[model samples]
Each structure stands twice: as C-alpha cells, then as structure tokens.
Target: MRTNTFLFTVLVISIPYSLSADSFTFFNYYHDHMVLQKSSTGTTIWGQSSKVNDVVHIQIDNKEVAQTTVSSHHIWEAKFTSPSDNTPHTVSAVSSLGTIHISDVLFGDVWVCSGQSNMEFNLHGVLNATAEFADSANYPNIRFLHVHRQYSASPLTDIDSVDAVWNTPSEKSLSSFSAVCWLYGKYLSQHFNYPIGLVETNWGGTRIEAWSSPDAVRRCAAFGRKRNQYSQSQLYNAMIYPLLRNTIKGVIWYQGESNAAHAYKYSCQFLEMIMDWRTKFNTASLGTTSSSFPFGFVQLAPWREGEANLGFPQLRWSQTSNIGYVPNGLMQNVFMAVAMDLPDFQSPYGNIHPRYKHEVAYRLYLGALGVAYHETDVDFEGPFPTSARIDKSTSILTVEYDRGLHPIEVRSYNGFEVCCVNQTTTFCNAFDSHWINVTMTSHSFASISLDVSSCSHGNHVTQVRYAWRESPCAFKQCAVYGKMNNLPGPPFTYYVH
Candidate 1:
C-alpha cells in the first residue's frame, strides 16, 4: 500500500507463521473508499487474526502507527491518530499471518443513520428519485455503507455481512440506498466540502425496544422484558453493538411508528435508549470520550387515519419527551424535524410512508448543521409554541410562539382545538375532546389571537392543542408556518393559563 508522503515509514521484519490471507483480514466494515473518523488522539482499527498472541500492525499510507496482539478469541484492535487532511490515503494491516490492504481511505465525519422502516425507506421510493439518481455523480465524496438487516439474541463482536461496501455516490449506488441518509450526507458534503460518510443500519417495522439495550429498556418502568428471538434488545445486539468500535460524530434516527401502541412509555424509553447508546459508543469508541453526542431525529408524520387511539400524535409528543421541541431539560444536544404538516395520503408503498423524503432529509440536514456542526447562524427549528393563555373577558385565546428565521404566518386555524373539562384530570383524553372554530382576530405574527367563543366549555376550557389528530389537516396546510422557510409550527398541547 502507498504511504502518505508527509509521514515517515518504519520498517520491521516479521517471521513467517502458519497463516493465510483469509486468516489475517480486516473486519467486514473496513474496506476501500471508507472514511475514518478524524481524530488527533486516536482512531480505532480492528480485525480478526487466526493465531493468538500474534501482533497486528496498523499503517496509514505505509507508516506504522499502532499495533496490538491478537486475543484468544482471534480479535485484534489498534488505535492511532488519523490524519485530518482531506486527501485519500491507503490503510494496511500486517501480521505474522499475512498482510491486508485497502485503498482510497479519507478522514472525515461519520454519522450513523438508524431507526425503523421510515429510515430503511430507499431512494427508489422517493418522488424525485429520477433526478436524484442523475445528479448523484456530483457528490462523489458523500458515501454510505448499508448494513444488512439482522437481529441477534446476544451482542455480536462484528456484523455478519453488509449489503454494500463503502460506496461513493453514483447512479447505481444511490438508487436503492436509504433516501434520508444519502440526502443528509449530500448536504453535509456541499457545506463542508469534505468527505462525508453515512452508515445506514435500520429495519422496517421494528420497535424502539428492539433497538435499545437491555439495560436501557429495563430503566423504563412501563416496559416488560420478552424472551422472544425478535423481541427486545435483539436489533441492538446485532445492528448497533457491532459499530461501537468506530467513532461517529452523532446519529440521526427516523422511527417511533412501531412504538405507537405504547406511546406514553416512549417518553421514558426513548431518553433511556439515547443515553444508553451515548454511554456505550463513548466508552467503546477510541478518542470519543464525550457522552453528549449530538442526536437528531424525525417526528412521526401525519397519516390518513380517523382512530384517536392510533397514537401518532402522542408518539410525536413523546418523541420530544412531551416537551414539544428538543434540546430541552429532558434531552440535550438533540434536535428534531417535525413532519406533521407533510402528510402523504396516497403513497404507492402505503399512506404511512411518505414520498416527500426530500423535505424530511433537508430538515434533518438543517438540524445537523445547527446541533452537530455548531453552525450557529443556521436556523433549523420550526415555530414552536412557548405559552398559551385564554382571555375569558375578550373570548380570545392568544398563543405565543418562539420564532426561528422568520415570523409566524397564520394560515387557516384548521388544527386548533380547545378542551372543556367536566372533571379534573392529568390530560384531556383525545377521545373526549371536540373541535372548535378559531379565527385570527389580531394581525400579530409572533403571538396569535384566536377567537374561541365557539368552544362549548367557554371559561371552563382547560387545554388548547394544534394538529392533535392522526390527520389534522391537508398536506403542507397546517395552520401556522414560518413566513419564508415554510416550516410549520410543530404539533403541541398546552394547558390554558
């Protein structure tokens, strides 16, 4: 393998041993065109060696940097500082057994894009697939490694296999890959002008517990353990555990559809899972000692269902731990992309899977730019309600919002609803609530005034909410939006004060 010209090569003689090319090889995840996490202290490199006690040497551009002895289990790992330059370098691993080499490796940020079916949704299913595939060649530095779907009852040291190697963006490679993963990376590449790597590991119709560690799931009081093969902790064992050795910038998840039945429990379960992942990845990955890695996720999108118990709205709220927006007290260094306004009622795949993934990916990229990259100038958050108060004398309910890059644009108040309580309770049940007419009286942009005289409970109204149904309004027609960005105000339920 070629060595970097800036680095000096160190020569060492090795005695021949009873080992073949297959006996000494890098892990399946390490391959040509891969982007290693750029770290000044250390970047981890691992492989399997056939002979125990034998030393495995790792080299970047032919210069030996770190070495480690093969364990009794035949696993070996080495840590060395990876170069921060953008130029491609060759990586080589040498041992008494044999030498393995891969070409065209780069140092850059790597992100894990994971979750359920929505995350697994391929670019082929998107509406702009044709144009996207044609323009893929423009993003040669944006690459992906698609992990093959698998689940195990116990944690695995390495994955069994992958659907694809570290592949650069191409018409063929981009077509069948995860749409959100590719689009997000593409944006990063454009912004930073550096190599961007994305690891797409997700499965369709999988629950949060399936992807969460056993300890994480146990922390949720409402969650119960199951011994089934495809149950709790199975996906985390097979999918997430194997990638712990590699340092990642952060993660962007798209899920929660499968957890709708237990939406209330998600407020606790989701935070537990994020904390668990941060702990494990920080401890296992070399040079990543920080436990507060940036995490971004997509809130559940609206669907054409009338059943109040379906729990899509509740799931979205719980996604934020009932706080509405992220980076709150419950979740730090985290962000969300609200999708309630982007409903897909007639997708070819199904109503649940939206075809407008470009918007979702754009929003996710915006979050990454703001939270992960620390681009303070970028505004990604949608308009969020800060407070809601009712003026019984004026018969108007004024809701104040925290604005982002633009002021609030009150469209039609289609999703606004008021709750009249006959008895005191924690939250007004969705089934017991009814819709009321709301008209914009004042021309205020930051704070909106709604005429709520039509509310049956009148002064007895206890709560106010917007877009609180499986399908609250037509696609992209939610009541409130940003004046310029068109980012809809997120779905929220606030107590009247």
Candidate 2:
C-alpha cells in the first residue's frame, strides 16, 4: 500500500471550495461566489450529468424555480428569471443520484474583458500595485473569473481549465488578474452599490484575427481567402466559444500591436468581428438578445522604438475605422480610450506595454457609465474637432472643438501639422507637410488657432493632422488635453472641412 500526504494554503475565507467534477456538476464558470447576469430575458444554468433522461431541479433559496431532463449527450440545462437584486442567494441542483449546492451566488452585471498582452497585463504590473492590492479586500462585491489561456482549431463546448474560480477580490486572487478589468469593476461597484463580475479571457502576443471567428474573418473582404491558417480563429475556438452560452453586459478590449504590420486591413476586419459577435451572441440559446450592447477598447499606447514604419499611428486610425472617434458613421454603441500619451519605455515587461493601467481603466469606466448605463451627466469622450476652416484673409486655420464637459488645454503646440499642396501637381503629400504653430483661442475657450502663413506656395493648405506619429510626445505631455479630466486628445488626420 502507498500513502500520499498533501498540504494546502487557503486564501479565500468565505468560499466553500470544491475541486471535484462528478456525475452531476455545473460548468466551470458556475461555482461558489459566482455571479449570474440579472437579465429580464432570463438566465440559463447548465451542467453535465451521467444519467440520461433523468430530471434535474434547480432551486434558489431552496425554492424550486426550474427543471429539465438530462439529454443523450449527458448534459442538462434549465432557464429561469434571474433576480435583479444584488444580494447573495443560495442555489442548488438536485438529481436522483446526488445534489450540488453553491452558496454566495449573486445576480449582477457581468462583463467580458478580452484582448492581447495589454489586456493580460496583471495587477502586479501596474503602478502603486502594493497599495492597490492592500485596498482590494474592501470591495467584496467585485468578483473575477480568470480563464486559462488556450487555443483550438474547433469550437469547444466547455472550457478546458480555469486559472481561478469565481473569486472575490483579494491580494492573492488579484495579483495575477487583469488590471484593467479589476479597476473598471471597482468603479462600477462603487457607483452602483452592487455586485460586478469580470471575466478575463485573453492571451499575450495575439492578433485580432486570432480572437475573431473564422466566419467573421471570412466576412472581411480584405481577408476573404488570404488568411493565415496557423493562428487564425484558434483562440476564439477555445476561449470565446465556450462562453457563447453565457449572458454578458458588454466587453472591453485592449489589443492591436500584433496586427500593426497589416494595419490597412484592420478597419474591415475589426468591424466585421464586432458585428459577427453581436449577431452570434444574439442568436445563442442562452446568451442575451441585446445586439447593440456597448463595446469599449483602449487605443494603442505609444512605443518609443520598434520596427520602422510599423504603422502604429495607422493602426490607431484603423481602430476607429478611420473616423478618429467611435459612435461615428462607421461604428455605433462603441467607445475608445486614447492611450497615445502613455508611453512606458522603461517597463520591465516591454516598451510596448504601458504601466498606466489605472487611468486606462478609469476612462473605460466613464465610457461604460455613459454608453452602457446611459448616464448623461458624465463626459465619456475627450475633445475632438467639430469643424475646421482656414481664414484666407488672416492666413490662419481656426479649428473648433467640442470639448466634452471640459475646456481645452494646450500645454504645448507641438504636433500641429499642415499639408502644403504642391504647386505643379495641385495635390498635397507628406513630403510637402510641415510643422505649424497653434495657440489657444481666448474668446471661444474650446477652439485653437493655427498659423498657416508659411504653408502658402501657390497652393493653400488642404489638410491638417495632430499627433500622427509612433511616439507623439513625452509621457502624458500631449499638445492638447482636457483640462479637468486630464484625457489626451485623440490622434487624428482630416482634411480642412
């Protein structure tokens, strides 16, 4: 006979932990201290059962709510109206063979946060990490489910592994959790005074195509038949497919560096993926039918040095479908966090990953409050050009801005550029462009005046752009910003119109 001894260190004090998956067990996402979406359309509970044709009863607070028979595939599912209240409740699933119980279950808004390394940047990597970790225990209602990274050629019905169970925020659990997801959930918890669930499903060094489905990629005309077979749709098969049956509030994404080389096609591919996700999520048996759910993302952060002509600026433009802002003509029900000013050249991880995740998450929360929750009091976006024109009489280009709830602050007029049209060709090119000086308007307070006297060479200036470079300015020192919110103006290039 052989004997084995084991020692365990318990970090979660409230959860009644269980690691065994038996004849009747819920999916990996449902467990103690888990949160289900509080939807009027109802919520679905599913699990695997060995006994086919056997009935399984689902109860809340020991009161029977719904029941279903086990299918031939050894699976059982039951749907019921989820409670809107955020208070904890006890849930149990009973069968002829056994009974499975999960305590501390809460009904609340659940968000899926997905992307590449930037979204995978953990809490320990952010600034003031120790202080943040110490204060994490204060928000007990904010929960997290960190999905283990995986890739598959085909869709998965269930997750292969879980990095951590549905866990309440703590130093131990948050050390490796997504920083952007945690901070955004913390903001929501404080504002709504309720439970908030965040699902972290992301991988490092992955392109947008890998996160998108094959059907979505094929819909993109730019990638119709030229898509690479190695990594295309692999991450989505394993990571996102298994969660299609789960209802979610929205999604927050932070990716794009890996696809910078093919930045020109990003607009087509990204938009198609968003539409595909909305359509699929609406049609799924257990997912929500709200097809226009809010989607938010972080724009690429500045990188000091990398491949030449890597198209970071172009990729940033492509992120917005070349519109320079979300909720535009190209995309709706979407928002973005401008990260052009956050350049972290000394980060231990790499120059591409910035350490200012707290600010990014805060901005994302503001967008959620406005776009998702439909709160009109908060300004979710930074300053942007509402209109522009060149004063031929004064040789000045006055750009009017729609500063959302804040006044424009011009720290330095560094990134203003004017396209001087060539005399012979009657067309403007980058070679003919030159840096221009700009000043704050004393009268409007939301507008800037640029000196375009030097741009006249038998042809007047035809275009203008700002912060159109890999590293636009020093860290947090962009030329334009929102004075109160401290949000940098998004990078843009547009003709004078």
Candidate closest to the true structure, highest TM-score: 1
Which residue segments of model 2 deviate by more than 4 Å? Answer: 1-22, 221-230, 285-289, 305-310, 404-409, 423-444
Which runs of model 1 end up more than 4 angstroms from their true locations?
A: 1-22, 221-230, 287-289, 305-310, 404-409, 422-427, 434-443, 456-459
Give the least accurate 10-residue stretch of model 2, judged by summed lDDT: 6-15
lDDT of 1 by residue, 1-497 (tens): 21111111111112223445458878878989998887655788887777889988888898998889997767787888878789999999898877899899988888899998888899999997889988889877777899988887777778768999899887788766899888888888888999888999999888888888877877776453675434798888888888877888889999998888888899988988888788877767754534678999999987775545548888888999888888788788898888887778789889989988989989888888888878888877878878889888877898888883244444565667787655554457655644444666764667777777876552366778878888776777777777556777788888878
Q: Candidate 1 vs. truth: CA RMSD?
A: 7.2
- Please name the candidate that would achieve the greatest lDDT relative to the true structure: 1
Q: Find the number of clashing residue pairs for candidate 1.
A: 1
In model 2, state the lDDT of residue 267: 88
**lDDT (tens digit, per residue) of candidate 2 on 1-497:** 21212121111111123324347888787889988888888877888777889899999999999999987767787888887777899989999879999899998988999998899999999989999999998898888899998877767767778999899988999989999999999989989988898999999888888878877777664332233322778887778877766878889999898888788888877877777676666555354546666789998988874433538888999999888988776678888889888889999988888899988998899888888898989777878888778889888788777784235445666777777665554345333434353443332457777877876657667678878778787877777777456778798776885
RMSD (Å) per prediction: 7.2, 9.3
Q: List the residue pairs that clash in candidate 2.
A: none
